[model samples]
Every structure is written in C-alpha cells, then in structure tokens.
Target: MAGVLLSAAVACVLLAGAASASSSSPRVFTVGGVERGWRQPAPGEETYNHWATKNRFHVGDFLHFRYDKNDSVLVVTRDDYKRCGADRPVLRLEGGEARFRLERSGFLYFISGSPGHCDAGQRFTLRVMAQRDNGAASPTEAPAMSPGGSFNSTPGSGSGSTRMPPRGNAGDGKTSGAAPFGAYHAVGAALGVGAALLAFAPPLPATISDPPSTAASFPAASPMASRLRLGQPNPNPGLSPSPGERKGEEGEARKPEPRREVTDLGGGSEVVHIPRFMSRETAWEMFEHLDKRIPWTRPTIRVFGRSVVQPRDTCYVADKGLTDLRYSGHQPHAHSWDDFPVLKDILKEVHEALPGSHFNSLLLNRYKGGSDYVSWHADDEPLYGPTPEIASVTFGCEREFLLRKKPTNTKSQAAGESGETARKRLKASAPQQHSFLLKHGSLLVMRGYTQRDWQHAVPKRARAASTRINLTFRRVLP
Candidate 1:
C-alpha cells in the first residue's frame, strides 16, 4: 500500500510538470523532398519511398503535398493505398497544395487522385510512431496540431473545402476539424496514473537514432549514422580508393586533357569542358564514397524577404583560412580537408587540371533528381577576388549546364551567394548563349572575367530520374 501511494505521488508531480511545460512543436515536411512537389516520382527516383527511408515520422507531424491544380491528393487506408483506389478516400484534398496532420500511430497512406498518376508511382505510405518514439515526448501520449493545422480544409484553395469524414460517435452526424484541448488534459492525467501502476514494464521501442534526452531514448548510435560518420568500423566503407584501382588516373598533378571550348565571353574570359579529367572508375569510387559520407543538408534560406528551403543538399570543405561563406544568411560550416581522404585526392586532380591553381575551397552539391537545381547567378564576390578560376567535377547522373551573357547595361553588385540569392534579381530574360551536357567523370573550368560577364543556371528537368553530384573547386581569397 505504501509503495502504491509513493508511485501515485510521483505520477501526479510528473503530470503537473508536463502540463506546465510548453507543448512540443509539430514538424512540417515536404511529402517527398522533391522540388517539383507531389507528383510522379521520375524514372530512377521512387521519391516518397526514398525520402521516407531517410527520415522518421512521429504522431502530430505534418506532410505537405504540392502539385498542379489538375492533381489532387487522397488520404486512404492501407488497402486503398495498395490498389491505388480513389473510390473511398478518407480525405480528398485539391487546389494545388494540401497539408495533412497525423493524429494516430501506424501507417498513413496518400495517393494521387488523378486517373493515371497513382499507377505511375504516385502513392506513398508513412510509417508514423508514437511521439515518445522520437525522443521528444514523455511516455504519455498528447494530442497536437500544427501551428495552423486546425482546419481540415485544403490550404491553398481560395474556396473553403473540408474532407472531414463522418463520425459514428458524434450526435450531429458531422465532426469539426479542430481537436478539443480539454479532452487531451483529462486523457493525459489518466495515462499518467496508469503509467505509475505499470512501473516495471519493458522499455519503449524508440530507434537508436533518436536523441538521448528523453526517458524512452535509445543509448547507442544508429548503425547507419555511425557508418555515415566514419566513427566505427564498416566492412564495406567504399570510401578509400586503392592505388592499383587508379589505372588511368594521373600519377601526380598534371596538365588538362583535350578540352572543348564552350565560349569566350570577351577579354581572357572563357568556359571550357574537359572529358575524362579522371578515369570512369575513379569518378565512380569518389561519387559513392562522398554520397554516403558527406554531411549533406538542405538548409532554409531567406529569399526575397521570405524564408524557403534550398532545393538541393550542400556541403563545404576548405583549406585552413578562408573568407567565411554565408549563403543567403545560412552558413554551411566548413569541414577540414584533412577529414575526407577522397576530397584530398580530388583536390590533387583539380590542381593538375588547372596547373598553378591555388584552389582552396570546395562547394559540393548533391541533386537528388532533376528538380534539385541552381538558379542563374555569378560568383563575383570579393572572396574570389578578380579572374577566379573554378574547376567543376561531375559524377553519377548527367545534367545540362547552361551559361548566358550578362545584360550589357546591368551593373554588378556584390553577389557573394553560391546560386540562390541573385536568382530573382538576375533572372535570365535572354536565351542561353551556351548549353553543354555535363557528363560523368568530366571537368569544366571558367576563368578570367566569366564572373563579370556571364551567368549560369541548372533548370529543373522533370523527366530526369538520375541522381547527380557536382564538386566545384574554387580559390577563396585568404
């Protein structure tokens, strides 16, 4: 009897403290992280499924779907999700965009309502766990809503539309979209007491990747995370390249191979493309290594007085001292070149490609598909100084590289950003002056006044399904 009373007292105190603590914020995620939004996953990209594998979802999280007006999103059960059936949908959302909030645990399914869309791989399932599974909540469950998820109405629709299904327990035969807060408090209180009663239950099943801050958190590092970080032994590291494997690679930093001159933008300004900068085998090895190990992130940036996530993932690596790089107010913390062996090898190749080149900074971009792109902009910053030479190496998928002459009358401002800022201001109104297919294992160089007179962009290719990675080597002024 005394032990029961003690546990009860502890439960009440915990419940009170939790009630006083601020509710955790719900996370909003783009359905598949595709820049083109919720549409058909291109040929090689099983977008939503691919994205789901990389992230963990919890109750109260939001999944946003962005598509054309002609397309609609259907919320369905597991059976419906499998057959691509739209006849009986839990919810049908249209008008270009929609956001759905998870209210329970288990697999939630979504599919395109258009006739042929789901058939072409437009459906995806989200495996959501209890809040505690993410190490962000107490073992007790709590009801949550997104910052503005009170409505079941389609978000981007001008006309209010609700897909609220009929409820069996409600008296009015209709249910309001908003949840009652008082009910949650009462339920939480009851759960806290029940939790105390079952004091010695087995531990919760939160993933190892979850942060170790909550009571239910796992104590060990995630196998995937550990391997990605290079902290532990991984049999198939695939990062280190063997000397014998470098059959056609240069013995040391050498001269550029025969190149195709793309264009000459005037005095000393030229863009040239070089194929086979490194052997095909070397390119493959480097791409595979960097793909799994690089700490890639698609950070949000302030653009045109508003904040938006960058379409592609990026990372920075540089030699000792260099000008700090801030891309539209977000800084990708630079990694030491010493940490990545593959980068050191690539740097040696870049040095050979452009003999006497003092390239010290590297900007890496990983495009998941055609949707991930860089807009038109020049790197005419004080950091690069004047007449900077940039060597760009490619691997994985091939993408179209475009360059256009800057408007003659336009004056140059300090456009220090990588490729996102000057996009809207320097929108390319004229046709592209040169369009080159950047092939795998190829190298491209732009020197002299190219930054002063030309702009470049990688536009979205909806049909492109191949993944691409580009390593752009630049000489950041110390």
Candidate 2:
C-alpha cells in the first residue's frame, strides 16, 4: 500500500510538469518593427490585415504598439473601424508605447487616431480565441511584466494600465518572457484601476481636428454678413473702426467695418482685387498649414527640346469626377482632394464672397523667394472653356502681378508688304501694360475675356522677397 501511494504522487507530479511544458508562453509582436515606427504599413510590406490574419491570438496574449507622440492608436467598434472614424474611438492610446491584452474571445478593432491616417489604410481587426486547458496552467496566471519590470494586468485583474516601455526590436531576445503563476499579485492590485476602466469604456469621442473657423461661429443674421452682402463692397476698404467709431449709444458694440473690393480692370476683361480678404491670423494659419502639409514638387518641363526642372514648386488638388490636369507640356498627376478642414472653410468663404463663380479645382504655386518666378502666360487651356472665371488667393509676402493686353493681328498691307510691316505695326501698337502689388491675404478674380485677351505673369523680383503661396481656383470641364 505504501509503494502504491508513492507511485501515485510521482505520477501526479509528472503530469503537472507535462502540462506546464505544453502551455505556450505569450508572444510579443513589435508594432511596425523597430525601423517602421508604427506608421502606416509600407509598400510591399505585410499590411495590418495580412499580419493579423497570419497570427492566432489567445485571450491572454497582448498586442504592443510603439509610435511617435504625434501618432496614436485607437480601439473602435466594427462599424467605426470600417468607416475609419477617428472621431469616435472606443479607446485612445497615446504616448510612445502601448500594450492591449486580449481580455475576451472576440474581434477587436484598432486604427490610427491622426487625421486622414486611418483612411490611408492604417487600421486592423483582431479576433482572439479562448485560452486552452492545461494541467499546470491555472486560469489565474500572474500578470505579465513590462520591459520596465513593472507588473501589467492579466485578464480581469482590473489594473487598467496601458502604459509600456519604448519599442525594441524582437530580434533582441530580451523582450520575450513568461510569467510565473500567482506572482506580482500585490504589485498588480496596487497599480490604480482608472486607466483600465477607460480602456474598456471610453467617453464619447471628440472631433479629431481643430475647431471651425471664425466665420462659422457667426449667426445667420450677423451684421458682417449683412454689411458685405453679395455684389457690394465695404464702404471703407482695409480700415478698421476707430475708438470713436467703435463707441455706440448706451455702450452698445459698434458694427464691424466692411471689406472693400477694387476693380483693377473693367469692361470686356473683369479683374477685381479685394485687399485683406482674409484676416492676418487666418492668413498666417493657412500659410503655415499649407507649407507644412502640401506635397510640393518641381516637375520637369520640355524647354527647347531638353527637359529642365521647373523654376517654382507646384501642386494640383482636384475635386472628384475630374481628370488630372496636364498643361504647359508638363504632366502633373492630381492628388485626390482631401477636404482639409481649414481649406474647406476658406473655400466656403470665398464662394460666398464671389457671386456666380464656381471652382472645382485648385492649382497651387509656391514661390520660395525673389528667385522663383513664372514667365508670362495665359491660363487659356482648352480644358477651361472659353470665358473661364478664375479666383486667385494670395498668402505670405506681397508680389507683383503683371498683365499685358494681347497684341492684335494687323491686316496684311498690300498683300506682300514684306512681313516687316506687320511686325512693325505689332511693335508700335504696344498693348497696354498694368501691374498690381498683390498684398498678403488678398483675392483677385479674373473673368470674362481675361484669359483670351490678356497675359499675366509673376515676374522675378529685383530685390529680396519672402515666400509666397498662390492658389488659383478654377473649374475644369469634362
């Protein structure tokens, strides 16, 4: 009887050791690896879907994310995940590193919280399965330890912390480890539970982008809108209310000064210039935003049979349903127009200010300094049907806009009066020339026969000049 009992105890011990060996240790996946820095999956690389599909996640396994402070990770619902809704995240993870342990046996969604990043295919769905049975493995295994040696929560531990150490490459071997059962229980319970609650149940998501522009804050019956109704110019152009003018009866606030528009060229050719069309603050904001966000390019152009780089940088942002624009022997592919909030707001203001003018595309030009310039040319492309109306908005430093009337063709004198006579007449006629100083925050509208009858250019400045950004909004017919 003593021998049998001893044998039974040994058998139990062997069985427990076998179960422990069979239980798998949790694996760690370095988000985007160390080189990629948790950004959108690169070309030819394994996408989030591809990566997720290849791995089988268990309830106890953790998904680690490592990225820059500017980027973020978001847990969202299936519907929100499909739509790439950055504004309605179920959980938001900031900081350099984050770890989310699979607590339930179901699908979990995640995406980049940055604007437009999610739409760029930076999201993934994870389906986790229940843990397998093992004799040595208990349902109550101790929580995993982070790289910093701190205890991280296990399923139902309620520690709720998402913080983790900075990302390190998996090849280093130091990031892999298995936790002993029932260890770190005291440390795990002490770590607060607020973060865990938020991780499971987040507040209503807020807008991921900046607030609306000042114009959007005004009421429908605002005095500014009433004073600057369509087709009417501000009584006093570029001048604000004086202290005396600001005072009203019984201390009531005075009406804001109206904006003015100066008609540079009238009659057959329409050219209207509105000085300070945008506020200084708004203009600076736009300038900085565009300078940083726009993907500027210096395309190559055919010059006298040899290709040469363009003098200035340019970008084409087009609306939906329009083909890419190619002009001046240069083919620049159009980038899908992203309705950037600020630019959209600015477009609304411009559309409201200009009556009967509709713009569907914008051709942006960046003049880095006095050295960058565009030679005389007319935007008389066939794509822009005859009598095309163009709205040009200027930001940054001031620059000169030169316009000259197209030379008229003289009737052949005496059938064969030596081509010199026609040339002489063309030189003598000398189409009238005009130059306007396009100040910052100004809008210039050119309509009617402007493209057909006149040529415009931003000539190189003789003296030093700061950077300038010009947006020429136009309609491109199919």
Candidate 3:
C-alpha cells in the first residue's frame, strides 16, 4: 500500500511539471527591432542577420513583422532568396504587422517582396535550433499583447522581456492572431517534434538542398516543343468503389478500374485525364439535370467586323459574392451558385481529386450537335489572375480538343507589318498542333503557363454527333 501511494505521488508530480512546462510563452522578436520597423538596413547598420545571430530561436518562437501596407513579405526558396526573386514564392504575406512562427529546426528564408527592397538589404535567413526535452509550448496559443506592449508571458518566467517594439503610428499595437498559421504550425510542429524524438530520423542538414526527384514516381512523355501528343493510357483506371461498396465482404476479388493519367506538355504545362471520373449513371444524370434545368444563353461577340452570335449555348455560374465575368467581348451575368446543387457537388468532387486547386465560378457550355463548337482562344482573362488551373468536366459526346502553340515573337515580328499581313504571317508560321478526344464522364485539367503559350479550341465535326456539355471550373479573384 505504501509503495502504491508513493508511485501515485510521483506520477502527480510529473504531470504537474509537464503542465508547467507546456505553459511557457513563445518568445516574439520584432523583425527589424523597435527603432527601424521593417525598413531596409542602413549602410553598415545592423541587419536582420546580425540581430538573428544574437538570439536563439526555438521551434515555437514567433517573428513579428511590422511594416507599411505597401511593403510585403515573401517566404522563398534558398535560390530565390539569393537572387531576391519574388516569383513562385513558397509563401507570401501582404499588409502590415504579420507574425510568422518558427516551427521547424532547419533554415528558413524571408525577404521583402516590394521591388528593390530585397536588394537594399531587407532579407533574413534564420536557423532554428533543435528543441530540447523541456516540454515546448503548443503552437496554437494566440499571442496577445499585455499592458507593457509585449506578448503575454507566463508568470515567474524570465523571457518576459521579449515585447513589441514601440511604433509611432502603429494601430492599437495588438494582433488578433487571426492569420492562417494553422497549416504552417501543424507541418512545423509535427516535423520538428518527430525529428527530435526519433533516433533513426533522417539527417536534416541546416543548408539549402535540391528538391527530391519525383521522376521515379512519374512516367515520362515525348518532348515535342509545339505539339500535344496523344495522352498515355490511364495509369490507374476504373471506377473506385463507392464508400458503401468498400466495407467488408471478405475475400471478394475487386476488379481493377481504369486509372487517371497525367501527360507532360513541357514548359511547365500538363494535362490530367481522369477516365470515368464519375460513374456512367451519375454522369448521365448530371448531364440531364444541367441540360434541362440550366438557363442557357446565346451570347454575341464582334468578330470580323460583324456582331455574330456564338456557336454554342453557354451559362455562367458563380459563388454568391463574385462579380460578373466578362470574356471575349461578352459580359455574361452569373447565376447564383445556390441554384445548382448538382454542380456544387461536382465541384466538390473535382476539388478533392485535385488538391490545392479551388474554384469559385463555372462556365458551362452546351454543344447541341456537331455544328456547335468554339474557335481557337486561351482562357487568359485578367480576372483569373496570372496562372490559373482550369478543371474541365465533360459529359455526353466525345469531341476532338485541339491545341496550337502561340508564336513567341508575334508582337516583335509584326511591329512594322499591317494588321492583315501580321495575321497571315502568324497563320503560315504556326507551330505543330495537337488534339485529344475528350470522352464523356472524363476530366481534363490545364495547369501552369499553358494559357500564355497555347491556344485551344473545339472544331466543328463533319459527321453528326450527340449533345455534349462541358463545365470549366475557374477561380475568379476579387
């Protein structure tokens, strides 16, 4: 009985210690200190590197950036950091007074996203030291400002001096902690903790390294510069069993389904073809629902000096708050997305299949027969932003989708040529073209710089064809 009581007391003491350690406050460091804010370093003045080297940053510590709204922050790769390039940043933060927590135990790079700021010494590289066994605080605790303008620190802790630096025009000197740091925190905390605890953890050197090769995991395709080759066979074909069908019926041999296939188009362009993305029955049901229920319109555009009606019927559906979309001289008003539940469900499925791609608007096209088709053009509207991922879902008849590479020097070469002459030259010098027969119940995704380099169209077919409906999901930026 005495021994049992002693063990219980020891367990209680350990629990108390763990609770106390977990409550420790994360240290917050001002990016350029209180005097300078996030300005460029003066000649021979202490830069961010100088200040960072003076302190010991742990996984849970926060780096607070206070700057003007015009300036921005970019979390970039090591190569981008060295060149001060802002393109393709790993992460970007705009506005003033952003807080980034150091969640991993390796090197992290940051730079000013504003033009010329990075060149003027407004960048920093931080190395987070490995965490110790002294139970670190959870990454979720919101950083609240205390009366002394410092982050709230635990009572009787010596790290209380880490406070917000004074600013002349800073608003409220407080943060709501509403930033989307959850993803960063989770990734960092898991990696940091796991690396520290595991004896067989891979050696994480504190230097920039090349990205791991994904070639072994993915197949290769032809290297045609200006042509789209026929897409390869589906790697993992067939309909995945529905959730209800996946449950136990032990020892039942499941038939293999046709797999989705991805084809590389070079220049960071690719197409993902998903065979039978939806079951045949579901696809037909959706096609019938959209065809009968949608309020389709025949929009007109000025082509060849005449106001010609479009060849195909179209409808625009968008989220409730999005502005009307205008493309190719047609300003189409968007229908409320709530009116289309089937499309919303389809969009959800597309989102699940393609991670990181989010769609806010869908442009639906109805090709009544072989005669209805669209001309050559790229969906490169400014509203879609710089580079957009378009998820196109096809239902009904199969049609040949053609792609032709745009002339690289069209503008420069036509500088002195007449408009007609320039157009003729471009047609004569057009690069190799490619085509794909988009099947019913399949999906095609166009990614990367495809819009800037390629133009696509569905040419009219010579023979009679069944009605086809296409839903091209897009993200319209505010």
**Alpha-carbon local distance difference test for all models:** 0.65, 0.62, 0.65
Listed per model in order, the count of residue pairs whose N, CA or C atoms clash below 3 Å is 0, 1, 7
Better of 2 and 3 by lDDT: 3
Q: Which lDDT tens digits does candidate 3 get at residues 1-478?
A: 5455444444443443343333234567777776687876654354565566545565456777777768877777667876889987765656566665553345577888889888776787765543422433333444644443343334433222233223221244323222123433543454444444333333323322211111010012232310132121322211233333332344332324447788777888777788778755356546655776678999898787788899999999898777678766788888876776667778988997788998999999999999999999898888887778998999999888888787566767877898799999877776768777888898988888788778889999976378999999999898
Give the per-residue lDDT digits (tens) of candidate 1, residues 17-68.
4543322445667776647689875543434554564455664556766788
Using TM-score as the measure, the top candidate is 2
| Better candidate by TM-score, 2 or 3 | 2
Worst 10 residues of 2 by lDDT: 210-219
Span of ten consecutive residues with least summed lDDT in model 1: 210-219
Q: What is the TM-score of each candidate against the true structure?
A: 0.43, 0.46, 0.44
Residue 121's lDDT within candidate 2 is 55
Best-to-worst ranking by TM-score: 2, 3, 1
Q: List the residue pairs that clash in candidate 1.
A: none
lDDT of 2 by residue, 108-207 (tens): 6788988877665567766555443232223233234554433243343322334333332234533312322332232233222322333444342321
Q: Give me the runs in candidate 2 sitting further than 4 Å from their true place.
A: 1-258, 264-267, 409-428
